[model samples]
Target: MAENTKIEWCDHTFNPWMGCTKVSPGCAHCYAETRMDKRLHKVRWGKGQPRQRTGVANWKLPLKWDGEAQKATGAFDESFFNQAKLSQKRPRVFCASLADWLDHEVPTQWRVDLLNLIEQTHNLDWLLLSKRPESWSARLHEAMGGGSELARRWLNGEPPANIWVGTTVENQLLADERIPALLRIPANVRFLSCEPLLGPVNLSAIPTGEGHGLNEAFPRITMNPLRRALRDAPHVHWVITGGESGPNARPMHQDWARSLRDQCAAASVPFLFKQWGEWRPADDRDSDRPHWVGIPDGSEEDFSDSPMVRVGKKAAGRLLDAVEHNEFPQP
Candidate 1:
């Protein structure tokens, strides 16, 4: 768990466990998977042994964060949350930074326990994102309230108000496949992360703002929500876009990010441009460059950074065409 983090969207990073399989292209240069191979050598990456949970201290962090956040909001005691006496501030928690909560391999009991913790932490907004939407219906439904959906149904939404569920989409396929499934659940807030983005994702239907453009082309994905309160209000409340980081990072096309920005803007969804990954728009040059190089076009050159330069995540920054899109869903 993190008390301080560099990820702009959320506050703390809580890890229920640390491991997962490489099921999609977004998993190509997965920082978590790579770290498993290098840093946490005791645990291996892949299907059989993806990762293990940390000690209980790490597990109880959200409670501590909730209390502190409540104290800051002048909600110092059990008065807690009522119409007029609610805590002024709620700390945002990015749950499972190192593992997918939806991963079928993670014991159902772990998820049930984690859900219990989330319920106890009254003043924290938990963000539980996953790459495995395919497993959501089965795993989530199965783990409901001591293996019974009764307690979950007692609440209006399946998850409590503090929890915001999301799915990761690196390309069109995931966006298409996952969006509909995600929409089927009334998770309060639903979002999409297009990091390590791999190709043209026509998220004209389900919308998020950004992620890395892809290395190879794939069939485009098309999807929609069950409905947006009669198709008027925003369905996908938030969108985060960025490029790949690390040594083998890939470049995201400017147009790809721009297209998403436009889509989010149209849908009235909050759009956050995370970063340009290891690539940035090429600066003006005296000599002409190849069509494949210099700031990418998402085509021509997939490997070499012709016009785009390897400026790294820091230097490249999170600006899309020099504009920093730091939108978030209103809490």
Candidate 2:
């Protein structure tokens, strides 16, 4: 129950349950797994392990937040433009930071209960970020009640006004695999969490078309199957990129973050640089530098020309080339 979160991007964080099997490379050093399983022993992390749901009072936290949001909404001016402004003013809830809401192993009833809670919290924007975007449609449809109109809208890629869906893309392969699946189901604001970025990712890679490649020419006679197959694709509304944190965290290439930020700027998509994580460029100015953690000699040697120094998360900070990117997509 992180009612007041320090996640940089969200107002609060709510995890319905605790426990998750590692699905991708990004989960290698999960802070949640470290804190919950190894330290707190709240729930074991792996397949076949049962997810432990939070207490009844924990479940009611969002209801309280929603009521507060409703009160704020009531104070806004009633003009049509102000309605949009009010939506933007709504507090964001980053749901299931400790577990995947669409995790196949979680009980179906748990997901249904979460959905019911979301329905009641229309005043708050629920960001349902998942590593498993492929399962989102089926899971959401079932949770919404299969034959209902709400279910139909979700299946049709138009989810509720307050729900924003997103997926994690650590590199090009995942960006290719997950971004397309995410774009297929348009949400109020679709986003990509490129946190713990493993390698350089070209967000505008032709076939993936994260938020670019719209002007590419199509074959007039349909001889080129690939070109003809391409259709106008939906754009990613926001991009959140950052390096890794925690023990054994991998250092992200500075260019990897820069590439994403440049791509987002070109596409007019909002971009948020969360943090530099546990590593920072060795050449950073003395004014911004923190107490340097001593690393073994030659440990800094890497394939890249520019080396990174382990500075701890607090010292590493969230500045990207000295600029703080705190942009968020319009609701």
Candidate 3:
């Protein structure tokens, strides 16, 4: 778990599980996959313990925090949980950056454990983002099915107050499939992560039908036709935007991010711009020489004279034309 993440959208990151199998086009540059492959190779050499193909290992366990003691003991305590609690001045924490908390491969007991941990650490808000919100929707349905007492106790009205649930919307297909599923979760604070922006996603396409099987489980958003359609669909309080990173990183054009920033502003939702990623527009690309060098690579042409499309997060990363570090919405 990274107590402080350089990824500006998330205040911190916690990984209950560290490995994942790719499930979509967005998974092509998955950071988790890269790390897992490295660890697996090491394990094979006996440098590290072997991992169960299906179960989460000790290293994959979610970091647990003890807030009650931390409140009483002050910040200097050496206890792990206390240290994490003291370190966070921000409101929300991103849970499981390397793995999906709702991944079917992770046992239900582990989910319960994670939820319980979230419940206990009430002071620190939790953001649970998943590419597989449908899996969580199914589990929530099952819990509600048997009229189980435990389920009733835990998931009666909506998700825990301290936890915000969100789903990744990489492209249109995934946005259609996963966002609706996310709308069904009982969490009070629901949001969207359109990070590693892959394509131009029009949020208006989200379904807003009534009596959709999962509608009652999660309330819909109401306002404009697009917002109203999504109203009662699932309430998205915040939006985090970013471009891809790492070698072979995809270039996210400036227009794509600006469109989202504009939409979020119109909707009155908080917008966060995370990074520029690896590539930028030809004009914005850093040059070794001064402008007086006059396009050293070739002609005496001005690079800035080209069409104004900025690539990479740094050039396009500005949110509402300014850097905005938003506080987490109330849980």
Candidate 4:
């Protein structure tokens, strides 16, 4: 992972570790897993070992920083807090795009190092996304050990102000299981990522209230399903919506994407439409070929240098509409 990435929704990507096991349907066609298996074979072999392609130990490389802000001092420094260029400024850094920072397989010490990086980079907003938000929450509490100053700081509302905790909600089942766990983590910003979206999810249908049995004297806090159910849950401020891409990319209906966009608009949340995946729309349900041929509009005209493609062909990354500018959280 690096400071520069073409992913439209974020300013940069940072992965302190590499490799992960699939935890949900969203991992069906993970681009990162494929890249790790095919391209960086040797890095998967062991720790501190040099891969065939790169002579140096891959772990020793400096965390990719886009600007010439100089190296970070100690584990936590102001340099790490510097912002990216305005043209490239999306503010939110996609933490662990290639690996799960909170994966159980990762050493606890490594997680501390990653958290240190997050704390150090205070100026740039950090977006921590995971399919295993529960594991992350558990590990975090364990690391802080019940209630230390560090734990108190996080629990007492000093959880790296730049960090936003989120979880992936691909289908209703996963949404039901994971969203609640995501809400339990204490972070400055809380939101959700429903991209590579596999099925429709209705957040309104979720149950809201205190879990089964607790002291009745607890004020009967009518636990706002959207807030209490989601730890310190605030109104969702940002949403990224996109369909799958690649040969086996699933078809996403225009209505589904539009519905979420509309919901976000109604709630005053910023919405970003990333792309239409490989399978295009066919007039008849049985038609083998896409009916509205040519790439989706708003997608880059040149496919030669684009990283995203559809069904082994260059996708213009267009939307149902004939426009090309789908970037969101607009300035």
Say which candidate scores most in lDDT.
Answer: 2
Please write out the lDDT profile of model 2 over residues 1-331, one tens digit for every residue: 4467889888999999989999888888888899999999889999999999888999999999988977876743345323563255789899988988889888877887887787777678889899999887777667666334555667776667778888998877777778777766766567889988877777645354333445546422211111222344455778899988888877877778988888777667788999999888777364454434343221332435656777889998999989999998874
lDDT of 3 by residue, 1-331 (tens): 4456665655567765455566776777777666565545421211133322333443233233335334644543335433343233424578877777766655565565566556556456678888888787566545445443334554566455556788887766677777767666766567788866776666765663445666567655322322532455456777777767766566555566777777776776666666656544444454542322123111123334323333435554444345554533431
The lDDT values for all models are 0.69, 0.76, 0.58, 0.56
Per-model RMSD to reference: 6.7, 6.1, 8.6, 8.3
- For TM-score, the strongest prediction is 2
Every model's TM-score: 0.82, 0.84, 0.70, 0.71
Model 2, CA-based lDDT:
0.76
Q: Compare candidates 2 and 4 on TM-score and give the better one.
A: 2
**Greater-lDDT candidate between 1 and 4:** 1
Residue 75 deviation, candidate 2, in Å? 6.8
